[model samples]
Target: MGLAEQRKTLGYSQEKMAELLGVDRTTVGRWESGKTSPQPCQRLALASTLKISLQDLEALLAPSQAVERGAGRPKASDHPSSGDPDEMIRREFLRILTVSGALTVLPLDEAEALADGVYRGNPADFARMNSHLWQVYQLARTKGTVYPVVRDQLATLREALSGARRGNSFPLLNAAADLFQLAGEVAFDANRYSNAAASYALAASVSKEAGAYDLWACALVRHAYVDISEQRYREAVEVLRAAERVAVRGDSALSTRHWVASVLAEALAGVGDLAGCEEALARAEEVQDLPEGSSNGGWLRFDGTRLAEERGARYVQLGRFDLAEEALKKALDQSSLAIGHSYRRRGAVLADLAVIGARHQDPDQVVTYAREALGLARASSSGYIIRRLRSLGDEFGPLSRNHRIAELGAEIAALRAS
Candidate 1:
């Protein structure tokens, strides 16, 4: 579940949610964007609010499939009750969980030390810190509950970035950009769109200074998301166009430029410009022709199929039912596994399909897509998904008495009220 869905299901406004969750509004914004996850307590609270089991909430909090580790044989430790276990093994497992739980609430200095212990090398440290920051950002979306911790960490990271700049360290510059982007992500989760945009813009600039084209493109894409969310389609297109230009000069063309173009298509379609959307989509299609080894698997990891989902979303926006159905079907069939890891993404696809149904005045279609989307929205804790569901409900204004549509609307209303 996305943070936005959780907020909606719980009937929390971004600011109120932040206050209740003990976080700044910006932190909530980050969680919605998949830039972060909630801490254990926050997750419990979120689950309680959404009326989901803690186990289901944990499933939502798990890392996206994109970041899942490689498949390997199970360890002996995997069988907790195995007869081969030493007498002291269970105690150690409990101890580890206890320590890990305590560490989750540690202050910045201690957390940094633990991070250093967990990731000894510079590159490993970068990855580890980035991952933790992502998790923190996610948890921050629960509202006020996690704001103080994230705020302190961002302050520390900012200071570190400044120090690196003074030392003329390139890796530090890269790290600073990454950290700033993470901070921005947290801000976004809390619905602080302007702050999120500013931070991402700064990250893009710093990445450029570090000569990290992939990072720069990523920051720009994130910024575009902010614009898109605000329905500033023209502004979103302009930002994406800039990203496209920057991406062309980068090492990861297949992913970078393709993603930019795909987003541009969605933005254009949102503005009701079909021709522009089609043009951008065609460029995205061209991205599929890139060679297999073109992706570096860093930031710009597009392999063409990401655009498929965008195409479906754009067609939905354009009110092209046949085209939307075709694109959405293809998107569902070929989307990356990570897309399914977040209930929010799945709900978004369903929401798009619901819109298609609503446009055609098909009550059955609306019920089928909207109800499942509402369920997913509740599971994910995403305000944005609920907002989208509201849009779908609006589509029923002309057919309010339609029993199926009204039932779907009532179900969504109840979810939002929870």
Candidate 2:
């Protein structure tokens, strides 16, 4: 039987299943009707709730023969094979999570060895998988969806590390470092600052042990970001300075140093050091000279593409509304920001522009930008965007008394509550 038949056999109404899965009832309906498949993050829970193996769940969700024939859809075999490397990595990741519970009941040594043998998981495989997960995390509207898989991967990494021989340990340590940074990102996006801080600390520690200078510096930069987000500019500057020193020892071909500089500029601006902020921003702009592939795209995505927005944000922080608006408008015109490719970035830019409006006492401009930002926050379900909107709402000050601005604040408040 298909998903619908299976659901009925299990006596689960669509609403009941939706409630259990923490998804909308319509989402469940679409899954059963084959209009959509469960996301990677939803697959584990869906499989557990439906009392089926993940493989079986995939079968149920597969396009039916009749539908395939009617719609001229490609046959299953004609599609990417399950044996594809990426597919194998994903399946292996889920399998590890599924059996992790049972592993905990076994003797520590035996469990570690068993986990090691299960996949004989190569460091390269883990690295590739970690990269894939980062992409998934970036694209997912609900960043929290990545937590389960990331947790499972961390558990697996711990197991591998526990039983690893001395010769193989370094690579595994590198992988662990990379994964921890991702975990920190997921936590940071959720506004779990403490968790993010802890994760970044672990990442930096492991990266240092692995002698991966770039990774180590990147972790420090991320750790510093938590401080910047909390408005601890002095603390952030200390961390960023350490990161800067570490990055100097890393591959100059990479943009690690430049990325650190960019973030340092933000911290400087927060502390009202306009000259220092400008100097750091100029240093960051040197990233434009780096060759292609300067970034690994997973942990270090900074490529000069964000300079305009970053400059604008720093200007906003320093109360330079004229410079801020000019830079922010340029950033807004970028294809990714313009087309809403990254809701977080676009929302942040919009919020910054709204703040400029508040500074100018222009209620119309504030409402225009704030409204668009709020809509993006709601659509993306991004805590990062919500945080930006919250900051924008605070900027309204006396303008919050304005009818349109007050209404906008109310909607933002409601969104935060939800």
Candidate 3:
């Protein structure tokens, strides 16, 4: 049975259990929620109070994924029985558990060091893995393909966070911030904006605690994307402005401040603030001089390579089809615009060109570009690409009677986003 079931089976409320165990009621609650495991001393008392052996208690503490309900015991008992040798071995096992348990509850560097001896991967490995995952995320056909990795990464990071000592917490905090941002990106890509917002907020809080200015700014900028994706242009502008202010306090070498400006450009264009958009784009250009190979390349991956696409998309919003066409075609020519590979980015450009076609009162060009984009969208299974095609479809209302346009509209409608 689950820990909560065991507690109730023994007729012990969390409050009473906490009092008997000399811990907080919330600690008991966390134990029940799988957020924490008890210390060895607490385990001894808990096993006695719940009338279970240590082996059964260990099974109860196993992570949900590591457990099997029906197959609870070993097929055959292999333990040595009632010998002095076996007793000595059990003593050593309990001793190691005691030290590990003490370390789990202690909030000091020495305790953390002792726990590190248990050989879980270090914080640097975590940061490096998260970076690679972000590259994979960008290159993945469907963004949701990255979630299982993100989820596992978050679980590992949570274990580290719960065991962190204050003196040794800077790396853990920074890692948490980076991982939380990655989690937010996965959630954002999946269109789970509420979960995305919460993850971004946690990242910002942890980054601030670590004095990680760039990480903090990135989180706030992501929070702004939640606003922008919902069409809250004015709110997004406010968020991006706040992020920019935070970015000013970040390292110039890292391009955090400039990246904020890049997002601000999109929000400004969304609101039809042409002058503001131009200024923001100009500010984002400063990233060219900052540095290279510095981005975390996972959550903080703003190198300004997509400026052409951003500029074209902004121009599309501004109704400057001539400028949009020139910029978007150039964007489509870059190596980043491969058909099936960079479908999300490439499809977006095609959709913009199709919009430009619609703007010019050319139904044939609209159907032509839109059809290619729809094909890429289907191949990629990208929700963002599908959304872009749907947006372009809105402009085809005037030409609804045109056979090809109507057919293209129906094709876009039939996309199942598998």
Candidate 4:
């Protein structure tokens, strides 16, 4: 029998199983759905609670993945979610009153001690660790590969929260807020928008409670990206404007406002507000005047380094190729060459240059950059990059009589099919 069948036979609802195992109920849901497996540390506990032999549990887990996710089968009507990771995240957090029983009930002294342990480490240590995770995230080929590490960091933060007293929550709060943003990034890269939104919302809420205004503003900006992804440009602009107000009240030592303006430029561009987009881009460039080393890289990655690409993308949106190509080509030069260094970034810039080339009626330039971007999208395995490539894919239809352009179109179609 599969996991659901076995759970049914034992008269255990998902909540009951999670309670007995003392883990998030979402973990149980993931296991039941074959979306994930129990970690090695938890396998014994899972097997014991299920009242099955280890071999039998393995048997159940192994065959169930195919039965559940091999496609060509009808999903349950009521569940309304098949394999979307965002649904898993939303249901998991939505179902929880708190992360775990221990967190909900731990004594203040114990929580204080846990927070104390976290505080014992230098705040810079946590900042650096978060910064490194961003570097890794940017360099990874498959972004979902970062999810496990992000989840483990999340568990650690929750462990501290379980033992934290109110007065002791400051440092823990910083760590939690930063890590939650990272968690959101991972979910976003995996195309799990609901999960990303939830994480960003929690990050903003917790950062506000902790009185970390810059962090709070940063979280709001991250949340705005979800709106942008859905093409709700007006909504995104609203969110960015709100973020701007919050950031203005934040610490000037941080580049929170500058980051806000950078994203604001993109949102403005999305709505075809050329003047607003240009103003926002100029505001983002104010970061260059901030004291050197303004970014901790954890919460503040925009240190004016991305302005070139941002400007290029904005101009592209404004249909001003005359201004875009210069900035985009510069962005391509400034982009990294390290192994697997987020080909998505380079791919995006290249894709934009190709679009600009198309607008200029330069088919050869279009094919040249488009093919390079397609290669990066293939190598990086980033859906975001592929989506950009697909935009160019559509524009190529008019040029398909050119065999080279036709060939490139076919390749993109093949990639989408795969």
The C-alpha lDDT values of all candidates are 0.65, 0.81, 0.73, 0.74
Please give the lDDT score for candidate 3.
Answer: 0.73
Q: What's the TM for model 1?
A: 0.66
For 52-130, candidate 3 gives per-residue lDDT tens digits of 9878987887753242222342111111111222221222222332333332333344433432332264766556555
> TM-scores for all candidates?
0.66, 0.77, 0.70, 0.69
lDDT of 1: 0.65
Ranked candidates (TM-score, high to low): 2, 3, 4, 1
lDDT of 4 by residue, 395-414 (tens): 66567788888888888888
Where is model 2 poorest over a 10-residue stretch in terms of lDDT? 74-83
Which stretches of candidate 3 lie above 4 Å from their native place? 1-121, 335-341, 416-418
CA RMSD of all predictions: 13.4, 10.3, 14.8, 12.3
Q: How do the residues 1-418 of candidate 1 rate in per-residue lDDT, one tens digit apiece?
A: 5556766877888888777767788777766654444543356666776678878766665543122222232232221111212211222222222323433555546554544432222434544455554444443323323333334434444544454545555676676677677767656655678888998988899899888887788789889989888889899988888888788788753567777777888899989999999998998788768888555433444566566667888888888878888877676665445532345556777888888888888877788878888876766567667767877877887767887777788887876676
> Least accurate stretch of 10 residues (summed lDDT) in model 1?
79-88
Count of backbone clashes for each model?
35, 0, 0, 2
Candidate 4, position 77, lDDT: 19
- Which consecutive 10 residues in model 3 have the weakest lDDT in total? 74-83
lDDT of candidate 2 at residue 231, scale 0 to 100: 93
